[model samples]
Target: MTVPAPAADGLPTRVRIHEVGARDGLQNEKATVPTEVKAEFVRRLADAGLTTIEATSFVHPKWVPQLADAEALFPQVADLPVDLPVLVPNERGLDRALALGARRVAVFASATESFAKANLNRTVDEALAMFDPVVTRAKADGVQVRGYLSMCFGDPWEGPVPLPQVVRVCRALLDMGCDELSLGDTIGVATPGHVQALLTALNEAGVPTPALGVHFHDTYGQALANTLAALRHGVTTVDASAGGLGGCPYAKSATGNLATEDLVWMLRGLGIDTGVDLGRLVATSAWMADHLGRPSPSRTVRALSHKEQ
Candidate 1:
């Protein structure tokens, strides 16, 4: 296969999308998904050629009741042909993940104090401090760690988060031994200009775009536009959900992450290779949407489903 190089505009001809439908997507759902269904969801995603599938979170049931079955779900998808990273909020969550033999885990940190307090019940610095030990022990266990920095662009409580604050948190996470950073537009308020400006600032701050993954929410219908900006900056990793499946519980105004199928559609149009089969992916999302008892928010899935008539 001839790998295409970057375009004249500098967008890479290939991108690796991090699939977050199982953990991040289902976590926000009010109705509880059966443990078996959740496992099957992860299986379908891996079968669709998703290289990195976030299987489940080891968060407390009281906090996220939907993913309370993380321990149960992880065992089922652990052997898939992909990197199955589970979310670990603290030391305890990490313990559960490690005991289940998780080879890769994710720790989430917030850029804004309000989101930190709301989601983690700790101040920004306090939360990072809490994650420090988790990262440390995960390292000892030889588990790959992916750091998620939420509210990188905007926060519902604070609104319009500054770049420096985001940079500080991101740098701190990298300093704490996070293998990669996933910058999240939690409230989905970022435009392409904002995305570009932030990536530029992060690059200037010593964090390369290669180590950063752009996670956008399509709330304002800017997910694709902002994603183009990230691509133009040479970003390779993107966090997208199957069927556009989730929203932030803490950020009530937040919507779902960029749909994986939608991202693939744009990348393929730009002649970018994602190694994901768009038709199989859409069918997966459509099937998932049916299970959730709602039509998918993904335009690609909707358009294809409409055409099947």
Candidate 2:
């Protein structure tokens, strides 16, 4: 598929893509992926020229046994060229990540109350409150924090989330000194119009858009389109997973995130430099999918591999 091109005004023709396959991608798998494979996944991602990769989550073993080896995995690839970030749900998670010498950590919150309670077991306010100490401690230790706000679009239980709620949560995270805020389409219910509306609202509310990133799932196959909408509004950062490895554990019907290979293909075609090699990235995705005993969800990877054959 031919990707679109950006404008020619020399307006900084590069974008930042955060690879989340390690944490969000593998967290929901039924089969357990060994620690060695996870380490190789991070190594291959860095080799693909990805500078930022979410390596694992520091959640409790009972919560996500897939990443229970966070300590083991962090040390295995701690010296990689890319920035390996781990998700820290609370202060305890933060402590675990810090103990492993994690340089960057991500905290998550939802815009709707139902998702907050179901996913994080807290209300929006409560979730933010819980992160206060975590963020405070991480900053004190010189650890960078990236805040994630899920269900930025519509929700399954509650369709069509209020724009004001999204703005409120994003502003709160920014106020809390989050280095960046990633707007997530958790259930993949967002459209380009919704992306524009929310971004505009945040921009009008004096929230810094530059520090904002977009995370879209392809449940409805609109992830790339929504990404375009974000780019048009000057959102330079995007979150994607190799081979589309992640699915929301809370939402049964949700699919994996936008495929990193596909996103890179589109960006390269659009004259936007992502610093990622599409061929190597597809190979990496195929390897991981084979290891997990499942076909990849990345359309670009399948097509590219078939064409090469």
Candidate 3:
């Protein structure tokens, strides 16, 4: 394995990698991964130095049966000294997460009416309306909330989402008391310029860079590039999955997320500290790939693990 020499670009000194392998990554699995396996996956991700790992979603089993064991799984890894944010679709999901002592929760929103209807069976504003009390209650309880704005860049149904539309929903989430927002390129259609433009637009809309995180999918192989553009614009937090293990369950065109190993490798090369152990992350994803009976899709994971083989 070759480590790229540290080359400090005009980027943040340290970036936070929000690990989503356990929750978003596994939610699309056709076979139900045992609860114990999911628990171990989260544990290993924490051990690999990912500070914030999304644990599971509280969505109904009818919607995402893969994470039906959120109750059984949360307590299993709750003691770990890390941020285990769970996804809560509505007030009901928030209740389930708070019951298990989850301190951080995220609400999934869409930037387009098409995705809003397809995923949540509501209009864009209606979905945000549903999350209004959920965010309010979570903030009232002192729980940190993250607003995940999916289809921020492009929608499979409505191609090329408008920037103002994205900024509007983002401001609504922030005004509604979300601690931060994760802008999701749900279909992986964003380019570097699009990423920068959106960030600038968000900043002009009074959504500070610190309050934003970028979640890019690799369906178009542009996640890393888009991330670089964000970093150059003073955004530090990035959302990725170990071994690149995730896709939108509602959007069939969506593909695996930006791989944690791939993101770490780029950040490490650029002399950006992420507090992640690339070796352990690759190993963890490899272990999970074995569990799923498939090869990991992450290029860096494959490259590093192949050298060991």
Computed on alpha carbons, the lDDT of every model, listed in order, comes to: 0.90, 0.90, 0.95
Regarding lDDT, does 1 or 3 come out ahead? 3
Clashing pairs in 2: 5-270
The true-versus-predicted C-alpha distance at residue 23 of model 1, in Å, is 0.7
The residue-by-residue lDDT of candidate 1 on 27-69, one tens digit each, is: 9988999999899888988888889999999989998899888
Winning model by TM-score: 3
Worst 10 residues of 2 by lDDT: 3-12
Question: How high is each candidate's TM-score?
Answer: 0.96, 0.97, 0.98
lDDT of 2 by residue, 56-141 (tens): 99988998998889988899999997899899999999988888889999999899999999998888899999998888888999
Can you give the lDDT of residue 283 in candidate 3? Answer: 94
Error of 2 at 61 (Å): 0.9
Clashes of each: 0, 1, 0
Per-residue error (Å), model 2, residue 116: 0.7
Q: By lDDT, rank the candidates, best first.
A: 3, 2, 1
Model 3 alpha-carbon miss at residue 7, Å: 5.6
Worst 10 residues of 1 by lDDT: 1-10
| Candidate 2 residue spans exceeding 4 A from truth | 1-12
Question: Residues 1-309, candidate 3, lDDT per residue (tens digit)?
Answer: 445556466789899999998989999999999999999999999999999999999999999999999999999999999999999999999999999999999999999999999999999999999999999999999999999999999999999999999999999999999999999999999999999999999999999999999999998899999999999999989999999998998889999999999999898888888999899999999999999999999999999999998
